[model samples]
Target: MAKNLDVIEQTTNELTLAERQQKKPKRKKKKLKAVWMYTLLSIFLVVSIFPFYWMFIGATNDSSKMFTNPPTLLPGDQFMTNLTNLNESIGIFRVLFNSLFVSGLYVVIALAVCASAAYVLAKYNFKGKKFIFTAFLLSMMIPYQATLIPLFQMMSDFNLLNTYFAVIAPQLCFPFAIFLLRQNFLAFPTELMESARLDGASETRIFISIVIPSMRPALAAASIFLFMTQWNNFMWPLVVLNTNDMYTFPVALSSLMGLSYIDYGQVMMGVTLATVPIIAFFLTLQKQFISGMLGSALK
Candidate 1:
């Protein structure tokens, strides 16, 4: 009888502990998950932003201190000196203008062409459509370097070397941009398009009034991508532009590097300067860019 009583008490205690465990709220677990997510995001953010911060800091220091044993994390006292030296050495304003002009024009014209091509390919039934799209997809697989020599030769034939047109023309028909816009265009409702067609709207009118307005997010996203591509482009500009005055920002920054005795501070300053416009551009369109890309995923 005493042994039975002890067994009964032990079972009751076990049951009570189980019940208490089951009654506990899950908020602590949820908080833990949130903490982990925030921690990861904070780490990633720091990793992404640190390089740019280091570049800015390096810009402020002279060459000797810039590459010290521990490496300088703090801004030094040479910001103005570097800026003045850079300005006097290279025509920074002219280089900046060249980059801005080339990038902006490329975005505008590239978007227009890519959007129109994507719209037609997505909506209109035409001969060789599959073949054409397949060709574009295949073209995307061709590395840019593979076509460099041919493109240079063609540009030389047209006597367009060193011109902004040479840079902008070749990139106008970007396969990836067309593919992206086409995907977004494919998501539009057929019923709406049919209704618009029944209303006797011209194709151009339908595209401008119906399609373009509906795809602002995609357009904004593509614009940012295209702008950044042209902005940070180094190789093509380096190869094509021989004149210092005509050189884009990336090419000009590279020019600051000497075979012997590279000026670390001046180069960093150029990089910092080159980076500002891109940062400003991204910030300006970040909302639209994110929303547009996310909307495509939702579709």
Candidate 2:
């Protein structure tokens, strides 16, 4: 019996050692894989951020240095000069005001219009409902350039050219906004709306007091999209707006280019400034935007 016990103990110890040896290679491979992944991600991060860093460097340096051999990797001392030149070139304050005003107002009005339209489409039954919704979706497939000529003609005939109205009017009934909000609205519980109705809540009250509050995340996401669309709108505004005073950031930035020479420093400065508002806007609503998009997808 003693001899058998000793042999079994030796066998058990050998098996455990063998098992640990087998796991060692797997653990090493996992660590190596993780190291490689991190290294690749670090490379990508640097590559992706390099352009913005270069832009900043350009903004702070002279135009001539932008093309120098070996390139200007560090920031220089021309930032103030570039900003002053940029202001003189485009009247940055006025251009900023125009862009901000148009984008802000568009967000507010478009949100209301889209949310109401989406609510109706999502919850209400009426004649030609599916057709109207389908039409909106099909309109998304149409090239925006295709409608430009007719929209321009219509705006011209209405004497809305060179006006903020022209800039804001054409995209007020944004199909994509309606569609996004509609999807989120569909995810809302119909039973809740019914319960509110049973308690003497009017449709308007239910929408204002309950629906809108509950859909804040969706609204934030949609507002970000709308704000970005109007803020970055170049082609439509370029076609309609003739005066420099009415130009938004994109149109204003383009004016920095010239046939004779381009001021890279000023151009970079303008671009850097123009990027601030968008970055700020996104940062403000990023949490809600993520939640809204994820919630809608899950629902």
Candidate 3:
């Protein structure tokens, strides 16, 4: 009986030791996996950041040095020179103002129009509502390239060429904005709207006083999207605005590329300057942007 007991005790100790040995490999494997994931993420981050770094470097280097075989990785001391050259080449402030005005106007008008339309689609029951919503979704799938020629022709017929209004007016009908606003509206609590209505508020009042206030984050998100789209707009503006004085920032940047004597440093400086406002805007509204994204996922 004693011998049998000793053997059982020894067997149990060996099994425990084996189990610990098995767990050790799993723990090491988990650590290795974590390390590999981090390594991949770091590589991806570096790849994404490298272009901005190169752009900054280019802004500091003269044209001759820009394409040097051993590219300058360090920030050079020529940033001021580049800035001066850029200002001399073009009135940076004027171009900047034009971009801001166009983008800002588009953001406000597009968001307002889209939000109203979205609210109607999401809340109101009407004949052919499903069809209309389906159409809006279908429009999103259609590439903008397909409509460019027709749109350009219409603009030509309207004689809106070279006008900011031309750019702003056409984009006010964006289907994507409508869809985004609709989704946001659908996610909104109907109880709030019902309460407002019960308080003898008019439909418009309910929308303006109750709905709009609650939709601040969604509006912010939409505004950012519209602003980015308009600010980065190149093709339509290029087609519509023929003159340098009315050129948007992107158009002006393109013009810089065409000079018989191209200046890489000055071009980079303009790019940097042009990007600053967008970055600043994003930084300021980042909280709202995040909230808007979260709001979308609420329902």
Candidate 4:
């Protein structure tokens, strides 16, 4: 009688377990989707980073070694020669300074202008507000090339050609920067600004203390974009800067390949060096840049 009662209890337990399993469906969809997502991301990561590795290897190897069949995958002893050639080809310090100074200044000024304008457009009610923001969006729609000639002529008229002012000025009023920052500013709590104002905080103080601190991500994202644009800017600088000393890094590097029989190793070294600043800037701000990117759309 005891054994039969024990068997009956075990049978009931088995049935209950089977019923529970039936109630909850298997969750394969999420797991499979995750697998596919990870695979795609890994592939993208490898593809994006592989070129930098290849470039670094090329930077180390000589032209002959880099050009070999089953191209060189390892570092070589020719890096010093490549560096010497690169420095000789383009006075490294001059171009580096031009790029760094112009790009850095452009980013700083653009952030201020864009953030201020965005704040006004987003938070304040005024006449022609819609029109102004519409114009900003419209500017982005227009191809930059269409306005280049007129802008170049204007800069020439202003006697800003071959000057850092030319490179830095035109880009300070960046349409995209304005648009991006405005989106972030839209999400700022109006109450906070109003409360600050009630406390006798001036507009500048309110903005500096309240608005800027809250929108770090947007500012970081804008700074990265502005820096990248100004740093890689080639055509305008080409038109403006006549002297080799005045040329930015990209312009100076391109001049190397314009010569017959390109010493690819030297070119790679210059490319590697030119890429360092951008990488550093991105890495430093990548967290904010990524987080802030969604502020406009999400809000």
Candidate 5:
């Protein structure tokens, strides 16, 4: 019996060694694949970040450094100087204020309007419901340029041209926002609304208290889009905003461009400043925005 056990143990050890030898090449292949994947991702990361790095470098350097043969890759000491020049060129503070105020207000108002419209469209059963939603989607297909002239004319007739209202009001009923939020709203449990109704809760109360709290992700996502659209809007504001004091970031930054002698430093500085709020806003709501987008997609 002892001799038999010894033979069995020797056979088991032999089989284990053979198995390890067989897996060795597979393990090496996996490691090589992982290395290549990480290398490619690193290269992509650098490529994606290079433009933003260049923007910063340009912001901190003189205008001439931007066009130098070697091209400056390092940040210089001219950030403050460029910032000062940008302020003088475009009234940076007023531009920042206008952008922040208009974008913020537009996000708030547009969110309320869109969320309500989405909620009704998603949960209610009524005549023309499908037709209305289809119309909204079709409206998105219309060229935005086509509406610009009509919108400008209406604003002009109403004495709203050159006002923040002109900028904020026209796109308040954003179709994409409505569609995104409606998809999310559709995923919400109707049973919960019914339960609230049974408890004598009003529609507005249910929306404000229960529904809104649960829809934070969707709201955050929609708010980001709304804020970005208003913040980066250029053509409409340029058409309407007659005064420099009323110009948003895009319009303000465009003011730095000259036909023959553009100050790259100040332009880069303004662009950098213009990008900051979007970054900050997105970062603030990133988790919610991601979840909302995923939720909408799943729905």
Candidate 6:
């Protein structure tokens, strides 16, 4: 009886120790997973923020110090000087105005044309509608580069080269905007349209008052995209515009690079200035941007 009791006590003790050991491994695994999560988040945060840091640092350093073997990683005191130089070199306000004008015009026209087309495709039934939509989709698949030559030729023939209209007109026909607006319109409540029509509302009146108000999120999203694309456009403008007075921000910035010397500080300042409006625009419409994305996703 004594031997049996001793064996039972030993087995109970061993089982308890085994349970404790298993608990320790599970705790260790949880800690390791937490550490890994933190490490990955830290890396992502650094990667996202580093470019802006370098840009600010470069903006505050002179050209010589900027390209040194060990690049400057901190801010210097040359910011004002760089700003003045950039303004003097390229009439900063004029370039900004040109960019804004072209981009704004493109956004307005694009929204009108695309949204109208999308409304028709979404709400109305006509022969060959699917075929027409398929053509638009195929057009989207074709690279922009492939269409550049033909577009340029058409512009040249129309004598629209070097004009703001040249840039604005082409962008008004964007297929992506058509597709986005169509998708949003498809998801819109048709009962609202029916109610408006029954109340003796004209099609144009209904579209202007009811449809547009309801589709604010989609319109805002499309406007942001159209504005950004027109603002950053470089190649087409470079080929078309020959006068310095008509130069947009991106084109003017390219002039900063010359055969002899390149102004790093001034370039950085210009870039920083260019990026500010876009950031501000996004911040203003961020709520709509998020809602539009979520709405599209849900649909």
Candidate 5 lDDT over 233-297, as tens digits, reads 99999998999898998998998787999999999999999999999999999999898778767
C-alpha lDDT score of every prediction, in listed order: 0.90, 0.93, 0.87, 0.89, 0.94, 0.89
Worst 10 residues of 5 by lDDT: 290-299
Taking every candidate in turn, the Cα RMSD to the unseen true structure, in Å, is: 7.4, 5.1, 6.3, 5.0, 4.1, 7.6
Clashing residue pairs in candidate 6 are: none
How does model 5 fare in lDDT?
Answer: 0.94
The residue pairs in collision within model 5 are none
Q: How displaced is residue 71 in candidate 2, in Å?
A: 1.4
216-297 in candidate 4: lDDT tens per residue? 9989988998899999999888888888999999999999876568888988999999999999999999988887766555
CA displacement after TM-score superposition, residue 108 of candidate 3 (Å): 0.7
Indicate the worst ten consecutive residues by lDDT in candidate 2: 290-299
Q: Which candidate would rank higher by lDDT, 3 or 5?
A: 5
Stretches of candidate 4 exceeding 4 Å from the true structure:
1-40, 293-299
Comparing 1 and 5 by TM-score, which wins? 5
TM-score of each: 0.89, 0.90, 0.86, 0.85, 0.91, 0.86
Best by lDDT: 5
Compute the lDDT of residue 157 as modeled in candidate 2.
98
* Candidate 6 wrong stretches, greater than 4 Å: 1-35, 297-299
Cα error of candidate 4 at position 15, Å? 14
> Which has the higher TM-score value, candidate number 1 or candidate number 2?
2
Predicted model with the maximum TM-score: 5
Q: What shift in Å separates residue 139 of candidate 2 from its native position after superposition? A: 0.8
For all candidates, the clash counts are 0, 0, 0, 0, 0, 0
Give the per-residue lDDT of model 2 (tens digit) for 44-113: 9999999899999999999999999999799999999999989998999999999999999999998899
Distance from true location, Cα of 126 in model 3, Å: 0.7
